[model samples]
Target: MIVPTRSSFSALSCLMGRLFSVYAGYEQQDAHEFLLNFMDKLHEDLNRAPHRKGPPVPLPALVDEAASLNVRINHFWCQHVDRHLSVISDLFEGLLVSSLTCLVCRKSSSSFEVFSCLSLPIPANKGSVCYLQDCLKLFLETESMSGEAAWHCPSCRQKRKAEKRMIIARLPKILVIQFNRFRCETAWQSKKLQTYVQFPISGFDINCFVDREQVETQPRPAYRLYAFLNHYGTLATGHYIAYCRAGHGGQWYMYDDASVTEVTLSESDKRNAYILFYTSVDMRHQFSSHP
Candidate 1:
């Protein structure tokens, strides 16, 4: 090592003094968190630099995240990073985020992957990519919010000749749910016609029954649609079904309707099962065989 002269040593000592002085002025707990975070980011950024900007990940292997995923540090770390410093804050935060990454089995540029939070909200900070775990935790209701399952290989998803497994996810904290049923009334359409349905959703063993009326006839068939209500209802894995014939009004069906006189889930969030809009009479008429 090269020994420094008195003036050089003095300057170095002054620099360290300034650093400790500033650090000491802040809350000790904050300082500790800051330091621990800094060291972790420092290690990650150093390690991640070598793995970036390579060829695309493989194909068949790439489809599985367990095999193709690898975390990359999106930013770097610095000892001088302070919350007040905008540039340093941005850089260090990115490094910290990417460090806790979940790699795919075989990830490529085209993988149907996005981020979600594990513990906090997506983007609780300045720069946030959703963490995968958080994405999985939330039940997919709307088509837009659904992830990879929302869409599948068009060719592969329709294979009914062999074994098939439908995946349903139960999300956390269902706050409110609603179910509505309407009886169609029309003279011309009223006849000896009944619509009976038995379809599976995320929860509840349900059978929707619609029967025509011989009473005051209207322009349409009299049909009774029983949209059962189920809250936190457990259901077998299957397809989601829905249908509308001209003037029919309906809402979602929840469990806890039959035995309970008044089933009200005022302070509950609904957990949705994963299934696209599916409708077919054959699937509904098989309730007897299904146990």
Candidate 2:
């Protein structure tokens, strides 16, 4: 869901109400049912008169609504409200296997973590980072943890320097990539990285980001861009907009506040992209076939 900066509660309510209206037409039973329940509660709450006029709802609060809805859906499903309501977890959840290697003994340890999004840091260079692959490569690159923060190796039984890296143990149907652009070194000062990152509209293969052993055995998943959230301006104050395609290989449109207009593939569209949304091509085909 997209809303303008400094938007009123009424504006947010209207946006969500319209979204639910569109979801009402979807044929997916599990998703439709879950959204219907959420929409009903939301409508009831929004319809109630406020005691007094207060500050406008922040963007982060609206973002948290998704998390709130997910929790509610999980509770309802686990309570046997629906046996087939695993769509949210199935589409967004994925596992990451993080490995740390001791530089001295070469002893390695690994752990699994669950994530719904992948946050990547833009590479620092004298020149601009030109491609999304460069950022992805930097994310998978090994870094040494030494000095005061050295890793304590159990095998070596001492504080030793270690190399750490993370690999995708499992891939999700919907992959959300967040660009780490905001940096805060001190309590008072914060900065936004304006590095231009080039990303592909389609055929983005993330096989290199996966564990080498897994990549050797399994087929690499091909992803196609579906939507992206962009932030314009600075870290302290910025406007959020989104560009999304209607269907697989469909035309793209820019969503700014309540206004939406068709946009062509161009460099201008990539300028402020903060979060990229990609879907597995295989999964898209499966969904289209089933639908």
Q: Which ranges of candidate 2 are over 4 A from the true structure?
A: 1-85, 214-217, 282-291
Structural similarity to truth (TM-score) of each candidate: 0.16, 0.68
- Candidate 1 wrong stretches, greater than 4 Å: 1-24, 27-36, 41-119, 122-136, 139-291
Write one digit per residue (lDDT tens) for candidate 2, span 49-95. Answer: 23213432222233343243234333332332122223444565566
What local lDDT does model 2 show for residue 267?
88
Model 1 C-alpha lDDT per residue in residues 191-227, reported as the tens digit of each score? 2111112223233211111011211111222213223
Cα lDDT, model 2, residue 92: 59
Best by lDDT: 2
RMSD of each: 27.2, 13.2
Q: After superposition, how far is residue 224 of candidate 1 from its true place, in Å?
A: 55
Residue 160 error for model 1, in Å?
30
